[model samples]
Target chain A: MADMIQIEHLKKCFGDLCAVNDLSFRVKEGELFAFLGVNGAGKSTTINIICGQLKKDGGNVKICETDLDKEPDLIKRSLGVVFQGSVLDKDLTVKDNLESRAALYGIHGTKFKERLSELARLLDFEDLLRRPVGKLSGGQKRRIDIARALLHKPKILILDEPTTGLDPQTRTLLWGVVEKLRKQENLTVFLTTHYMEEAADADFVIILDHGKIAAEGTPLTLKNTYTGDFITLYGVSEDDIKKLGKPYERIRDAFRVSVPDTHAATELIIKNPDMFRDYEITKGKMDDVFLAVTGKSIGITGGEQ
Target chain B: MNELFALTKRNTKLYFKDKGMFFSSLITPVILLVLYSTFLKKVYDDSFRSALLAAGADISDSVLNGCVGGQLVSSLLAVSCVTVAFCSNLLMIKDKTSGAIHDLTITPVRFGVLGFSYYLSTLFSTLIVSFCAALVSLLYLAVVGWYLTAADVALLILDVFLLTMFGTALSSCINFFLTTDGQASAVGTIVSAGYGFICGAYMPISNFGNGLKNVLSFLPGTYGTSLLRNHFLRGTFAEMKNQGFPNEVVEAIRESVDCNLEFFGTKVEIGAMYLIICASILLLIGIYITMNIIAGKKRK
Candidate 1:
């Protein structure tokens, strides 16, 4: 796949504090990529610099192989951004906000109508266009924001913490919409999220810590490398498990043993058949990989599923 | 560009749709008009007529008092328009609060579109308020037999438009300097209270002299007040003349009330005043743009 976005030697500082430090990364085309970080990890700063909302101190940024410094307006034209906060004019009706945003992008007439229709179908917000954005639910407002960004049919979409404050059902629904867009339109989505489970759905994940990339890989690979699978045996005696010499921790009524892979899980289950009545194998979670790489736990942990 | 127009349209819609703001802009001007009609007009007219009578001019009480009262009341209306226009600039704090401005800055739209659209919307709101005030004053003048010719009426409208544009430009500059909605509101109050007194909108500039009058002459808003008074009161001057009042005495009153602005000890031509006003508006706009560029470079 072609590199849709490339950044090298990026640096940003605010007074004495460095916000982003010599960051380097590439976002491949037609892929859902997730950027993970704790607070103040420079995720939004990098995004802002790329979008030309803020000037960078030192860096080379390219969008689809076009140097961002040479063709900033061109890069902006090819990208759609749903910023961290609500960008919609809450006092204006959803339709009015969309129409105005479309006009700013020079999208009009038949093309605008067609795009609005398609977005209405895709986002399931056809009936709520006339309502004021301030009166809408959080999920509904987010949908309008996404629909507004998609009006220009951008080649790349950047959603910065798009589902940060939404309900679980709404987050799932939004992810579903994004998945559909990824499959149907081959949209290159670059998103920042604290939800490790949400990052698991991405084609690639990069965890940032202290203005630098801490880890980067496919989600499954990162999970397998950083996190261990757990084999929990119910109704097992701690002394009976001592013979195997595998490290064990008694969790509630079960004796839990951590293993490197599923092969170890199968071997342990067969050997411990008499030692335990029932056994369960649990896959590793993404946060374990995040915690292992960053060494700092994130505070945003409500409804992360 | 189409983007500029679109943003202007959106801002205008958001402003007028705000019921609290729309009605709030009207309240002070309407109350001022009511006070002028019922209570203040007679006192001003009687005082001016008695002074004229004491001078042995023997001018008709109706004509002389009408001239004085009409000029004062309409000047109030024009100044009130500017005050409301100043209030309207507070609408921008919403954009910053909602983070809509951040969304706008990232787009492919030209920088001029983002800034000028705001100025244009402010211009629209100021014009609407001032124009309505002018119409009400015109209607009152006509009822009192101080009718203006069609050309004079057109000139009056032009003055209102220009005054409001000046107000819009000044208010836009002020709005850009403020970061919080509370600051904008405080600015609105400060302008409402302080600007009128200095610009000769609340009182005749002739009441002050020496350095104070000279200082007032340099303010851009002082030009707007002078423009509005000259346009709205020209008919009153003609009415007093037609009533067979002595030319010199009526001229003296016009000069005292500042029917024209003086620059560096010379009477400024109406055309020159317009040019100065236009230049000032453009200069302020240039400053606003420059500030935005500087801030966008240095800060978020």
Candidate 2:
């Protein structure tokens, strides 16, 4: 697949502090790309530069084969960005907000109405057209935000932490809509999220720490490379695990032993069948992989950990 | 061009839909009218009465009351038009704080168009509210005995239009740096309270000391105030002339009521006042456009 977004040595600074330092990444067309980082990890800064909202101190950015510096307007047309905060006018109804934004992209008359209606149905917000954005719930507002981003039929959708404050159920539903759109529209999605589980679903993930990429790969590959499979034993004594342990962590009333893979875990279990009467082997989680690479636990969500 | 109109429409709609902002902008002129009628009416009436009495001109109380009403209305509009502009233009700061500007800028819309939309929006909203204030002033004039000709009314509208342009440009330039609600309101409060006194809107510059008047003379807003004062009180001046009052006495009343302002000891005629106001409007608009262009260049 062709690359939809290509950034080389992207650098941005604020006074003396470096926000995005010599960062480089590529997002291919029709791929779900996740840029994961903790708070203030330069995720929004990078997205702003890509969307032409902020100036880059140094970089070469090409969007859809068009140089960003030379033709930012063309690049902007292909990008639909949902920023971290809600940008809809609080006093205006959802339809009005969407229509106004669509008008900015030169979508009007029958085309605007058709696009809005289609997005309203696709995002399951048909009933919310008349409701003012300020009165909507957080999840409802987020759906409208997504619908607004896709109003112009943008080829690439950039969502900057769209699910940060949403409930788990809402987050799942939001993702369902996004996944459906990606499939139906063949969208190249550039997502920045703090949720490891969300990042785990991406076709490619790049973990950023302190304005630099700590690791980048498919979720499973990242897990296999940075973390190890584990065997959890219930009702196992610490001393008994210590005798056979390569390395182990105590979890409340249970103990988890690290191994190279499921096979190694199975072999360890077989070798010590008497000692491992209540143990089960499990694959490593993406959270563990993120922890291994960034040396900080983003866990399931920023709120959770 | 469509993008500019659409954005401008959105901004104007947002301002009107904001009940607090819309009502606040309208209520300011009414509040000032009430205060002026209550407190400043007697002072202005006494000043006019004393002038006529000193010249032995037997002007009736109705004509004197009409003159006083015109002065109050003109003074109030001079400040209200600009101050309400500072209030109406808060939409720009609100958009900044709410991250709407970021959302808009990321679209295919050109940044220059986006900035121009803001300027146009402020102009439209300010004009609407200022016209409403003018209508209210007209109603008040009816009560006090209308002395204005049809031409005076037309000129009043033109003066209000020019002042609105000045207010929009001046507020847009100043409010560009405002980023938060607190900062915007603070600046709004300061401008609303202090601008009237500085521009000789609340009181005639004739009452002020020479030093302060000289300083006020250099400010463009002083000429804007004088323009409104001229249109508003010209009928009253013509009434004095028709009643057989001598030109010297009429000129004294004109000077007392600030119909003619002096810029550094040079009297500014009505034509010169319009020129100064227009020049100031252009200067302010130029500054605002330059600011937007420089900001755009910085991003590049």
Candidate 3:
């Protein structure tokens, strides 16, 4: 896939504080890329800069090979954004809100109606179109927000924590819609989320911490490279776990070590099962790998240790 | 232009959704008019009647009569105050709170277009409220036997439009200074109240001395109330000329009033230049603040 979004040495600062420090990344065309970060991470800031809602202190961003600074209007025309907070006018019915947004892009005539109907059918929003947004449930409102963003048939879709406040069932429903968009329209998606499950499905993921990219790779590559299969560990206290030495790692408050295969771990377990009382020998999941690489637990307190 | 129309429609829909705002704008003017009318009636009967009697020649009947026109002016003032305080401040706050402004900023739309659309919506809402107040006042005047003319009606509509623009501009300025909705509304109320008193919204400018009168003439509301009074009570533009109120003094007042009214009319040729300037300044400040927010969010 061609490079859809490219950021090189992007830096943003406020006074003495550096919000995004020398950030660089590239999102491929037709790829569902996940930007995973804790609260207060630079995810939203980076998204804002890409969307031209903000001016960067120094750096470059390009969309579809077009420089954001040089042709902001052209770039903006190619992108759609669903902000973290609700952006719908509460007093307006879902249909009216969508129609107003359509009008903003100057979409009109029979084509506009076709687009509206298409989005309504795809998002299952037809039933709720006449309902006032204020009266809709949180999940319904989110669907409407998504529909509004997709009204103009943008080449790229940026969802900023789109399912943060949604229930699990609703989140699953939204994820399905996202998947459909990716497959059906070949839309490039750059989504920010704290949900590991959400990021797991992305083609690529960028883990951010404290205004910097902590790690970046596909989910499987990141896990395989940063973590290992399994090994039983013994003789480690809460304080001693930190002192357990090289190659051995900690996962979820327990000391762990990776071995070549299950037989090796079993032989070790057979020898000293009591040594692994608080510890467990198992295949490393993405969460453990993320923690191992970033020195912090995924979805934990600001993704900190 | 299409974008602006869409924005205007969206804003109008939002305004209609807030039932509390709609009701407050509708009923508050009537209550204020009634209260002020009652108070003026008591004062006229108790003190003004004896004073008129002392001046001689059967002034009792006229003295006993209520100042329905003054009540109308008071109602208009009340409605203007509420509209300015509620509409502009809330609109600004909603943009920030709801994150809609951020969405618009990221779009292809220019800030100028967005600001103009908001001002247009505010102007429209204020016009509707002012028309409703004027209709109620006209009913009262009819009952009390006060004559009105077509030119007077045109003058009244123009007066409301000018005041609404001024109020929208003032509120936009306040919104830029204050970050929160509560602070914006509080500051807007105090500012509007101060202007209300100075602009002779509650009293006759003629009672004040020359220095104060000159200061009052500089106020936007002063021009609005004068134009409105010229229509509803003083009769026609030609009649105003024949009243013998001193051409020089009247001309001075007219010139000063004309400055405020004409600032949005022929002199400016924009219909909303002052408002546009105020919005531009405030919008620039707001953009700066938003940039800071983005920077702050990034560093964390």
**RMSD of each candidate relative to the true structure:** 2.7, 2.4, 7.0
> What CAPRI grade goes to candidate 2?
medium
Query: Taking the tens digit of each residue's C-alpha lDDT, what string does model 2 give over B84-135?
Result: 8999888878998888988888888876677778889889988998999899
DockQ of 3: 0.36
TM-score (0 to 1) for chain A, all models? Answer: 0.92, 0.92, 0.82
Most accurate candidate by DockQ: 2
Estimate, for each residue in A1-305, the C-alpha lDDT of model 3 and write its tens digit. Answer: 89999999999887887878999999998898999776656887899889887789998999999998778878878898988877878888888888877877778668788998999898888999888898999998898988988888899999988987789888888889888888888999998876777777889989887779988999877766776676545557646444433356655645667665556667765665556565556666667756776677756334454
Best by the lDDT measure: 2
Which sequence of candidate numbers ranks them by DockQ, best first?
2, 1, 3
Q: Could you list the chain B TM-scores for each candidate?
A: 0.92, 0.96, 0.70
lDDT of 3: 0.67
Reference-based TM-score, model 3: 0.80
The lDDT values for all models are: 0.80, 0.87, 0.67
Q: Give the clashing pairs for model 3.
A: A19-B298, A19-B299
Over the stretch B96-208, how does candidate 1's per-residue lDDT look in tens digits?
A: 87788877877787665677888888788877887788888877776664646687778778877777777777888788877787887788888888877888876778778
Local accuracy of candidate 1 as per-residue lDDT tens digits, A24-63: 9999989999998887888989998888888888989999
CA deviation > 4 Å runs, candidate 3: A231-257, A260-283, A300-305, B44-89, B176-178, B235-300
Docking class of 3: acceptable
TM-score of 1: 0.93
Candidate 2 on A32-56: residue-level lDDT in tens?
A: 9999877767888888888887899
